[model samples]
Target: MIEILKPTELPLARETGALVAGILQTLKARSVVGTNLLDIDRQAQAMIAEAGALSCYVDYAPSFGRGPFGHYICTSVNDAVLHGLPFDYELADGDLLSLDLAVSLGGIVADSAISFVVGDSPQPESVALIDATERALRAAIAAAGPGVHIGDLSHAIGKVLNAAGYEVNTEFGGHGVGSTMHQDPHVSNIGRPGRGYRLRPGLLLALEPWVMADTAKLVTDADGWTLRSATGCRTSHSEHTIAITDDGAEIMTLPKG
Candidate 1:
């Protein structure tokens, strides 16, 4: 379903977005070597509860995933890319971890994701992958505003990832968000400009660009939720939720001080 926020609803969306961003930032800071994925999930659960927010992940059972996600956050490590279910695994130095989070507060929802290297061993390839996704995300956001086509945002994002030499996957990409976590106006990572849904004020979109080092193919983990690169190559993902306005897109998920 596509949802457009009322002017009055935008403030709640911003509050929800900030809460999501702050929790993800905190999780990233604590994801050190030897930190277990379950611990990270617990931290997210605690924070969400303290903030009086509801997790969009735990109990989330979409058609694409196995029943009930049963976790507070997604913990993707190294080869893992999207929808990574938290498990009983300890992280290691040099591991590339991606944390994707979404939450609802005051009846509005916001979503975002970040990928980074754990510990001190930041590999060049890992850094490059993360940078490419981040740049793509920025470009996409810059292209978003009232009357802009969804394809324009997709094209902007695709240019960065493609130039970075990584293949783009369209199976899973950005989408609309509002009262619920996911919604209409599916935003692919790559596309032709001047095509697809037209943007409008009060609309919220979650723009994410992710890529695997070598291939566009993905494999599902035994857990039935984690998506990993077919070649086991490192991967990265970056995302943010933004609200379209008359001036331009207003980023909702910024870390709160």
Candidate 2:
């Protein structure tokens, strides 16, 4: 469903978005060498409980994933990209880790993700992978505004990723997110500008730009959740929930501090 939140509801969205950002930031800080992915999930659960917010992932059972994810956050490590279900594996230095989070507060939902090196040691490829995704995400956001077509954002995102020498996986990009975590008007990572759905004020979207280091193909792990690079190449994902306004797009998921 394409959900356009009312102006009054936008404030609630900001609250939820900030919460998501804070939790991801906290988890990122705690993620170090030898840190277990499951431990990160536990920390997320605690924070969500403290905020009195609802985790959109814990009970989420999408068609493509195993029923009831039963996790508070997604922990994608190294080659893993999307739908990364937290497990017992410990993070190693220089490991590329991505955290995706979604939550609801005051009946509004927001989603966001961040990718970073797990420890002090950082590989050239890993740094490049994360940089590409972050740059692409910024490009997409800068192109977002009322009356702009969804394709414009896609085109903006694709330009940066392609320039950075990374291929985007369109199977999963961005989408409408408001009352629920995922909604309609699927936003692709590559498309012709001035095409697709036109943006309108009050519309909320989760704009994510993700790319694999060397290949566009993806392989699902035996866990039936984590999506890894088909060639086992490093990958990165950056995302933020934005609201369309009369003037431009307002990023609601920025960190509080």
Candidate 3:
């Protein structure tokens, strides 16, 4: 379902987006060497509850994942990428971690993700992978605006990843998001320009650009939710929920001071 926010509904969306961004920023800052994934989830729950918000993940059960995700946030480390279910593992120095979060506040939902290296140790490959995804996300956002095709955003993102020498995986990509966590108008990471759905004011889209270092193939972990690189290569993912407006695309998930 494609949900277009009326002018009156936009304020709530902005609030939800701010909350999502703030939680992600808080989680990213708290994640470090020896940090337990479960602890991170707990932190997210606390923040959501304190803000009178609802978690889009806690009871989320989709066909591709195990029923009732039963978590507050997605903690993807190293090889893990999408739908990363929080586990009992503790992060180590230099571990590549991606925090994906979504929350509903005032009846509107917002989603976002960030990839970073944990602790003081920084691995060159990990940094490169994260940087590439961030760059691709930026490119995709830049390509978004009124009348822009979904494929235009995809092409922009794909070009950045391809140029960086990483394989693009389209199995799971961005999508429309609003009142619910996930919605229609699937946005692939790679495609031809001037195709697919056309952008319009008040439309909200979550544009995520993710890539694997070596291959485009993915393998589901035993947990049935975590998606990892088939070759065990490091991966990275970046995402943001954007609202199309008359001026251009407004990034609703940016952190607020």
Candidate 4:
């Protein structure tokens, strides 16, 4: 289902976006060395409750997942990439961590993700992987605008990841979000330009670009949710929820602080 926000509803969408971004930022700050994944989940839960917002992941029981996520945020570390179920694990220096969050406030939803090193470990590979994803996200956002094809955004993201020598994973890319967590218009990380859905004002899209160091293949963890690289190599993911406008695309999830 593709949900579009009316002009009057844009403010509420922005509010939801701010809440999601703030929580993700807060989680990143506290995810230093020795931070436990469970602790991160708890922190996310508290922040969402304090903001009077609902976590999209908590009740998210998709067929691909084990059940209703039962967690606040996705804590993907090192080899883990997507749907990372929080568990008993403390972060270590040089560990790559990705925090993906989505929340609903005033009945509007926004989603975003960020990947970074846990501590100052001088891990060049981790830094490079994160940089690639970040750049791809920016590239995709830059390509977004009214009348543009969804595949154009995907092409932009693919150009960056492929140029950076990383394989792109399309199994789980970006998607539409509004009034709910996930919606129509599957935005792949790689695609042919001028194909797929066309952009329109009031449309919200979550563009995420993630890559594994060695392979595009993924392996599911025994926990039934966490997605990891097939080769056990490091990975990174970056995402943002953007709104299509008459003139251009507006990023709704930028950190306010």
RMSD of each: 0.7, 0.8, 0.8, 0.7
What does candidate 2's lDDT look like per residue over 177-254, in tens digits? 877888998999998999999999999999999989899999999988899999999899999999999999999999
* lDDT string, candidate 1, 175-255, tens digits: 999989889989999999999999999999999999999999999988889999999999999999999999899999999
Instruction: Give per-model TM-scores.
Output: 0.99, 0.98, 0.98, 0.99
What are the lDDT scores of the predictions, listed in order?
Answer: 0.94, 0.92, 0.92, 0.93
Which stretches of candidate 1 lie above 4 Å from their native place? none
Model 2 misplacement above 4 A: none
Point out the worst 10-residue segment of candidate 2 by lDDT.
1-10
> CA shift at 128, candidate 4, in angstroms?
0.6
Candidate 4 accuracy as TM-score:
0.99
| Stretches of model 4 off by over 4 angstroms after superposition | none
**Per-residue lDDT for 1-257 in model 3, tens only?**
88888988888888899999999998888997899999999999999999999999999999989868999999999999998999999999999999999889988989999999999998999999999999999998888899999999999999999999988888999999888989989999999999999998999999899988899999999888999999998999899999999878889999997
lDDT: the better of candidates 1 and 4 = 1
Instruction: Give lDDT tens digits, candidate 4, residues 206-256.
Output: 999999999999999998999999999999999999999999899999989
Name the TM-score of candidate 3.
0.98
For model 3, which pairs clash? none
